[model samples]
Target: MTTSMTKHALVVRGGWTGHQPVETTDSFLPFLKEHGYDVRVEDETTVYTETEYMADVAVVVQTNTMNTIAGDELSGLVAAVANGTGLAGWHGGIADSYRNSSEYLQLIGGQFATHPAKAPRDELPDDGTDCFVRHTIDIVPERADHPIVAGISDFELTTEQYWVLSDAYNDVLATTTIAARDFDPWHRPITCPAIWTRQWGDGRIFVSTPGHDLGVLNDKNVRTIIERGILWASR
Candidate 1:
């Protein structure tokens, strides 16, 4: 039961199942509980429309991908954050979600443009794992002292390296490079934000592009970064 001493967290997760929204979100319930949050778990965004509950929520941990959000739902979410509700999410769950909603993109500060896969002998990977290229997630030297990534060092992960379309508004904490393979259309290497945070009104927004699956989420650095990100985003 929620009490005055407990912080409310609304976990809205649903959309493309391929992202493993349920399994992934489920992995963090214990962390949130340990942090004193009385979590309300749902697979819908309508919870955002419940003004009273929205008001009580200190943070929203979302994991919906490619789903459309209604105007009222989006508005309520925006209003709650503007009034000091934090938001945090990872990978397509946050970045690739609500592609039709420009307002949502503006809020997130970036969108998933593509993930270049390893060049094939003849053609590209017709199956899914091609995009799982080995890459290093480099921590930004200047921002290493930031609380979320404070003792973390640069690490490598064999997973999707997001080539994100990002704006300058985000305070990027970490980055990863997209290899400029000969077969790839992009000529030069590109660096994309692997982790970042944004200040929205009185609220905080946290994002990490590394959570491609359970394996990635369970990685020491990735898992630690996410746990810290959630705490840092909370009001």
Candidate 2:
């Protein structure tokens, strides 16, 4: 079938509302609709294992964080996506969930390593303030031509910049430097990859490290990056 044909998408959202999980999922619904996907929203993670789950679905969008699923169920998901399904998620939903499951990490290609919960660098003051943080994103020419990020221009954010442990299999798409400051000590500077895509068998996967809050998505640059990722990863 052609990529333009109607496709099915499953959206599983809701976990540790600190991430504003539901709102993020809600905001992304229209994007899917605009791209010709028949979307299904699940409030819990169990729907992934229903006997009649849409194995033929073109894409699975996960907005869940800090949740665990049984080994069998997680394996079922890995198998489905490996055999030609597509999986896409952003921020903690994809990288922070299933912290204890090694298999889950193998499929997703990364894990949330750490974040400055209370760091000395007050640039991102923890004083209950709301604003966007600006940083420069470096795009890898290797994936600059990929459909997901083709038209996306480098941008900045005012949210928690995620530090991830990514596998070598990942196709690094973009990155932002995490320089050392008073709150962070470093003799040299370091850079973190902010977005990436990977392949598993006939399946495809995409992940972005931004989107810590609804306000974070308010930036048009961040919104467009995620919107394109969903369409690019969908089978």
Candidate 3:
């Protein structure tokens, strides 16, 4: 747990109501406070441009999905992280934001290419196939000794299993396998990272790709990993 008297956390949330950005981000507040952080919640990306403000922040917990970040805001955010401010978030919020910005994607180390099993039928082809399905995540035994996933075990979640385009720079902590199914007719099963941590200069980055909704976020394993991730990432 963080013991810094001046430790602060900023949570920026908005874009794509389906992710319940407000509710999900709010659920982490009490936990942050319990860990002795002064927390701020923002519904806009403008805070990224506040250099003086970002300078004092210890951690940034963002939940914006499918939104474009302005060049200045993106630059400020990247600079802050590179300078040792921690960055952490879940699902689309952190991994899927700023689709057009390769710099942002590279900074985060991953991007959400598709959640093969979570797309609506209407969004699919005329063949009437379904894309969303349930899946299980297995903690990497070698990496399980890491603080964020120390006591976590293999768990099952009935939510969208994201297929992410990730960089090899990430230190993968947990993973999920997608089997070849009717909806996604791939020739072989594909395994992808479910939770990971990385470094950007002096900063820390943590990401988890399982919180499709409150129920998943509420899961004991998922919740514990996320909480630990935040604390571990914070300065």
Candidate 4:
């Protein structure tokens, strides 16, 4: 592939080791470079405080989970994206982060609520894998034409199936149904957003709910969706 080097991609990954932030994000470095991005990686979110640097970045691919972002740093990040810088990430890294910051949640347009296991008595695993039942990711029939998910058929995954809190503003491309088991508290099966995109101000945001570890990130469909999402979200 020829490098146009037309964009800058910033990978900000850290906060939780269970997610293997560094390893997971590193897997995509070659892809980004092949697709014309000059990638810069940071293990911390402090770069969010670099106003000019953040603004110049074409996209910020973040993977920090359950971490706190200082007010000023968060402000710079939000400001840059609002003015046209892109933001894209997967799983808890994007949705379950900065638990105390409602503004940050508002920016992503989604939040991880829970990932129910097989039995009600089953303790939740931080990794979110279903112990007994495999989860299915269904493409929204109406969204089969979206660039990020086009041609991708519905698929099943044994990994964590996320049940998230999201808004109607999101353009959801894929979803997974959390079946209500006899042992579960929720009587009705909950359908949650698995992959989606949001347009914030002049910037674009993309989120995929499947990434819990390297294996899931390496899945053909999951990887393709993430790659397309990143490119689509880039400035």
On lDDT, the leading prediction is 1
- Residue-by-residue lDDT tens digits, candidate 4, 35-144: 88889999878899887777788989999998998998899889989888899999999999899899998999999998777655546453554443588999999999
Query: Between which residue pairs do clashes occur in model 2?
Result: 120-183, 121-183, 132-158, 133-157, 133-158
lDDT (Cα, tens digit) per residue for candidate 3, span 1-235:
2334688999999989888999999999999999888899999889989888888789999899999999999999998988888999999999998998999999999899887745545565534224446788899999979999987789888878888989799999988888876555678888999899999988999999988778789999999999999988887
CA lDDT, candidate 4, residue 235:
83
* lDDT by candidate, in order shown: 0.90, 0.78, 0.87, 0.88
Error of 2 at 113 (Å): 1.4
Clashes of 2: 5
Please tell me which predicted candidate would have the highest TM-score against the true structure. Answer: 1
Ranking by TM-score: 1, 4, 3, 2
User: Clash number for every model?
Assistant: 0, 5, 2, 0
| Prediction 1 global C-alpha lDDT | 0.90
For all predicted structures, in order, the TM-scores are: 0.96, 0.88, 0.92, 0.93
Please give the distance, in angstroms, between residue 141's alpha carbon in candidate 4 and its true position after superposition: 1.4
| Candidate 2: C-alpha RMSD after superposition | 3.0
Instruction: Put down candidate 2 lDDT per residue, 1-235, tens digits, no spaces.
Output: 2233568888988778888888888998888898888889988767667634556678889978998878777877887787777889889999998887998998988888765433444444656543234566677777788777786777766667677887788888998776666645555656777898889888889898888878877777777788888887877
